[model samples]
Target: MKPVTFRNRTWDVAANLHLPADFDPAQTYAALVCVHPGSSCKGQTAGIYAERLAAEGFVAIAFDASFQGESGGEPRYVEDPATRVEDVRCAVDYLMTLPYVDEARIGVLGVCAGGGYAVNAAMTEHRIRAVGTVVAANIGRLYRSYGAAAMLDNIGKQRTAEARGATPLITTWIPDSVEDRKAAGVEDVDLVEAVDYYRTPRGRNPCAPNRLRFTSLANVLAFDAFHLVEDLLVQPIQIVTGDVPGAFGSMQEGRDLYDRVKGEKDLFVIPGATHYDLYDRPEPVARAVGRLATFYRKHL
Candidate 1:
């Protein structure tokens, strides 16, 4: 993996780029950007995906978000909706520079929050020819408020708060702990996995900076990855989720999102697979990666 400096809009983001062996500048190859889920960095699952994609002869990159991981931003771990979207755009900007790249064949792969960001990016950016998501958390309606009902009421409140010139109120991101999981009851749909993925060694990386912060809640609530989702369907989409009952029941999210799609799309549900399995398990990741390669081979 080759580490490089990447700029997202005004901010500089640190990213790792991987190219296949026997690569040549004279020949153009497809490119894919791998985005880790929120609270994660370029290592872990994104690293695995990047390596796999590189082996398959596609240029792949995994980057830290603007404020998190190794990237630079103020009030670290303080996330913002606008900047995150800009981060995605910036990633595409970086990919266009490589000698062996085919700009028209660029694609995106996002996991969890990264997945949501990828969806939001493709809807707005025309340069991305194809998009894929794994265990995606595209929850704008639930987050912007407090939960579901609060979001509805909070919209006007958030607007009023902004009008009043008060600092935005951010909710507490779920804690990273096994006990927290037990306390929260690990319901099928609640985003308990936030804590699970961010805290556990199964997904944790010490090199990825930032601890859980409360002040950035406004960004999570306000950022709607699927906003203008219907109008944003300019390219093909492929979503991967589990049929399991836990973690937002991504099965429903994937299905509903698929129904909303007006373009070419595919959805796969891993029987007996859980959300985390698709994140790193060898079999699950391999299956999704194969589908992704095939899909991109056809579309990108």
Candidate 2:
């Protein structure tokens, strides 16, 4: 994996492009840009996906989102839905410059919140020929009182506070250190698991940043992840989700997105798996990525 700096049409984007040991410059290979979930760096599940893809002969990338991880952006963790989605477009622009890449066969795969960002990018960017997601979150639905609706009110207050010109409050996301985890116990798979995986050693990496800005909560609310889901998607799409009890919500969202597709599409529900399980577990993720690569090879 060689490091490169990409941009979001603004600041420099930090990324890792993994080339297989047998990579042949004379041959054009399919490429994939694997986007990390919110608050996570490229080194998490996305990196796992990238490594697997590279092993399978595809040039793969794992990149940090603009405001999170190692990427440079203002007010660290000031993540916005629009900006995050556009970042994918910027990644595609960067991918086009790679000598061994097949620009026409570029695709994207994202996990959790990263899934939303990838879908948004594929909806708007024709350069991305195929799209795939795991533990896909419809950020908008979750924002607009999806499940665990109570949290929205607290988030709304944070938004209002930011709007009133208050100092951008910095909030802690994952446990800052091992001490923090000892103080608090791991609970559900949503926010806690997010903080746990991206912030702790279980999924933490060297490139990720530790601070999260509160204002990003407000910005994420405005992001309708499925905004263009219905009419704008013109490429191959595959949505994979776990079939655990609470995870059914994502399955429903996947179904909703699938029904609106106007092109080649697929949906897979891995039974008895939970949301976080898809993040890095070999079995479920392999199935999803295999389906994704196959879909792209057939379509693009």
Candidate 3:
């Protein structure tokens, strides 16, 4: 993998390029953009999948979203869903500039929260010929279900604080440790696994500090990643998720999304795997990647 940069308006987004070991500049290859989850960076599961795709002979890229990780933006750690969706387009822009990349066959693969943004981008960006997602989360729905009253109150308080020139409040994405996770009263098993994955060696990364700007909650609550997928997303799509208890149970969101998509779509379920298990767990991730690589190979 090699470090690279691409312009996203005023920001130079930091990204990593994964090229196959036998990559030849004289030969054009299919390309893919991999987007990470909201609280994570490119170096985590995103890089893992990107590198895996590269090994499958596609030129893949994993990038830090604006205002997060190594990327540049003001009001750091802000999770603007609109800007996050647009970042996928910017990634396509950079991929198109590569002489060895097949612009006509460009694809996108997003993980967790990033999956929703990938759907949003494909709804408007026709250059994305195919889309794939792993343990996809419709971020807006999650935010709305997370206690509307409390979320609203927090947003209001943060807005007032920002008005007074106070630093942006940050929301912790995980407990500091396993014991903390157990003590935090987390009823959802998926969230328990989430803390474990982000805080332990399973998929931890220094770049993912497990937090987001408090103001970002407003955008996440307001934006819908599937706003016009039925009308706008006509490209092929494949969604891979686990069928376990809690958030991963049945992947109702993926099923709903597939029904709404007005193009070829498939939902692959990895039996018994939870949401976070697909992040870096070797067996499940390998299964997800196999399905993804096959889908991209057929479409791209």
Q: Pick the candidate with the highest lDDT.
A: 3
Query: lDDT of each prediction vs. the true structure?
Result: 0.77, 0.78, 0.88
Off by over 4 Å in 1: 142-172, 183-197
User: Would you list the clashing residue pairs of candidate 1?
Assistant: 145-151
Write model 3 residue lDDT over 148-257, tens digit each, in one string.
77888978988998899987788786687788888878768787888888888877888888778887788888888888788888899999988885753327777788
What value does the lDDT take at residue 199 in candidate 2? 67
The TM-score that candidate 1 achieves is: 0.85
lDDT of 3 at 62: 98
The lDDT-based order of candidates, best leading, equals 3, 2, 1
- Candidates in descending TM-score order: 3, 2, 1
Steric clash pairs (candidate 2):
6-13
Name the 10 consecutive residues with the lowest summed lDDT in model 1: 207-216
lDDT, candidate 2, 113-136, per-residue tens: 788889988887999988988878
The best candidate in terms of TM-score: 3
